[model samples]
Target: MVGFLGLFAHMAVIGVDTLFAVSSLVISNAITRQIKVGIPVWFCFAFGFAFTEWSNVRACWNDGKEGIIAGSAPVFPLLCIKLLLSWMTENKEAFATRTNAGDNTTITTSATSTSSTSQTGDARKAGGDINTNSKTGDTTKTGGEKKKRHLQLVKDNPDLEYVKEKAKEFYRKNGKWPGRPTLQRIAGCRENHARNALRELKGAS
Candidate 1:
């Protein structure tokens, strides 16, 4: 070791070797980064060109698909066009269904609003206007039920028994219990409120 180090030529050679190794490592790192970026680019170009050539063959030679004949169109263009067309075709029905569902939701909201409005108008049932067969057509017999069934009903027909008496008077005057219109004018209870109370009484009996 001492004899080799003592030689001036040997010392210069060692320094040169160390410097070359470091330069080589730096170059290799730079080349590695370039290769990483270039590989994907090269692959894309190669695949695109190869597929284009293959498409040309299919267009000329007549690839054996069930519907297509040879030389109908350029193969590459046909593939691109069909790819987009098929995607639209696949989603068409789903889009239609979504549109219909939105319409249905709007219709349901409209119906709900209509029902609520009609309920307000229904608050005027005369006692005789009730139905025997319909459970909802029953009347509020006692004063408590007429007042307690619903807050809205209590507000409408504050005097439940007065309405009852009016219906009885109607029977004497007209020979029949007052029907829906008469009861509505007398008691001012909505159809639903009167009907629910009557039903409750009948069920309890």
Candidate 2:
């Protein structure tokens, strides 16, 4: 619809030559952009095209007003306003999507941090094989320490499929790639396992 309007506006300005010569080029460019970039970019292009067409039409009409151009009909600026509104609506939708994704990420991060802190406290209370360095006096978790349920050595773990699904779900929600730690927390798997699964999932994608 936008393309048709743009072509019509351009036709009114540049005559039939643009309709024949430029239309094919425009269609090809639109297809390329739609395939490579996305639909949002096309909306941006539509807004720009509408603006350009409106400017040209108004300029021609101005020239006619000053007796500089002959047979230049006055055009209503409603089309440009409508196009501008459409662009604004598209921007708002994009902004809302980003905002939702950011919110999900923030909430997930906060919950993960809190869960980690609680698990660490529980480990300390239960004396889960923490080692204290003699020189630095820093307590470090030992190899036997298990804060979260994870199958590190099980290559054929059934949770691997579940983790992959959750990883994709997280990406869809967050509008970004999930990190190893985030995937581990989401899928309740070991960081290494989550990392490997995410790698495979990304490769397949």
Candidate 3:
């Protein structure tokens, strides 16, 4: 009966250590958005505890000393991992909030300017039917011409729109838009799309 109790204790220790390791990996990945960097560390610490516990189990099985592997050994590593994950989560939240706020301000200003320009244009065209294509020399201002122009713009400025959309999506997803530098790194824009957009908005105003 004593030997059976000892075996149960050994199994219990192993089970608890395994659970700790799995939980650490899950929490770290969720907070850090890093599966590659976090998973390996989790495995390393888990294996370390497992190694020590297995050694103790073997010793017990051979009629050697039991309870040599203290619960504290695995508990310490688990605590450290949890602390690191918490720090990462806090940082991510702060950064996301700040980025989102800035992006929202910029977007709001641009929208207001654009809306003013559109209002002015509507007032001016109350009597005169102003033809949009007259200024651009786009004689073929039909649906086909408009579609072609839209496609051409996308083809010419492939990365510009892509970067803008990505930044917008990032803000939507994380509640923080990416900085210009990060957008440049990811999207590789040569000219400033935000500045161009601002100019267009001002013209419309």
Candidate 4:
């Protein structure tokens, strides 16, 4: 506990935002190792910031000296990485299991359908062909509509990719993602475009 308190004091010397940024990268890296998928670094930073701030506030209440000793500054952020990593690993495994089960079901159904079709030959060929064509046409129409909408979005935000790369670089340097206003200044894009770029970066795969 004394070692942890010393660590927190050192973190305090480094400043809260900077420490949080470093913590975010650490948390993101740890989670990626466990789950094979990384979370947004900004998310980890935000979580650490909130936790540290709350801990500081609570400890400082009633003129308490333990505010700095409460281990919230940087220690909790480091400790929580393990917790978050475990949580992510469990959730990811569960999702993978469910996805694999779904894929197996789909394959089984497809195989059964193929075998039945082979046996029936021409008996249901006309109906099956019609249904297949209808489904194919509907799928094609939906895909085209989606493509058109995506194209319009891209047209509206020509600087999106550029802003996204800049935002990533900012995160790498500062340990936090820039807000829309900062993004605008850095990317030299319009306010609305900056906002859209930030959204795209946050939702990026």
For each of the candidates, the C-alpha root-mean-square deviation to the true structure, in angstroms, is: 24.9, 35.6, 36.7, 43.9
- Over 176-205, each residue of candidate 3 has an lDDT whose tens digit, in order, gives 656665555445453476445334433554
TM-score of each: 0.23, 0.25, 0.28, 0.33
Output the lDDT of residue 180, model 1: 60
How do the residues 29-131 of candidate 4 rate in per-residue lDDT, one tens digit apiece? 7677763434665565666577566656665666665654564455565557767767877699798999999999999999999988887897688789999
In candidate 2, which residue pairs get closer than 3 Å at backbone N, Cα or C atoms, i.e. clash? none
Clashing pairs in 4: none
Q: What is the alpha-carbon RMSD of candidate 2 to the true structure?
A: 35.6
* Candidate 3 Cα lDDT to native: 0.61
Tens-digit per-residue lDDT, 48-113, candidate 1: 445444444554564465324333343345345435555666687898999999999999999999
Worst 10 residues of 2 by lDDT: 67-76
Q: How accurate locally, in lDDT, is each candidate?
A: 0.54, 0.61, 0.61, 0.72
Ten contiguous residues minimizing lDDT sum, candidate 3 = 64-73
Clashing pairs in 3: 117-204, 117-205
Instruction: Using lDDT, rank the candidates from best to worst.
Output: 4, 3, 2, 1
Clash count per candidate: 14, 0, 2, 0
After superposing candidate 1 on the true structure, give the runs of residues whose Cα lies further than 4 Å from its correct spot.
Answer: 1-81, 124-205
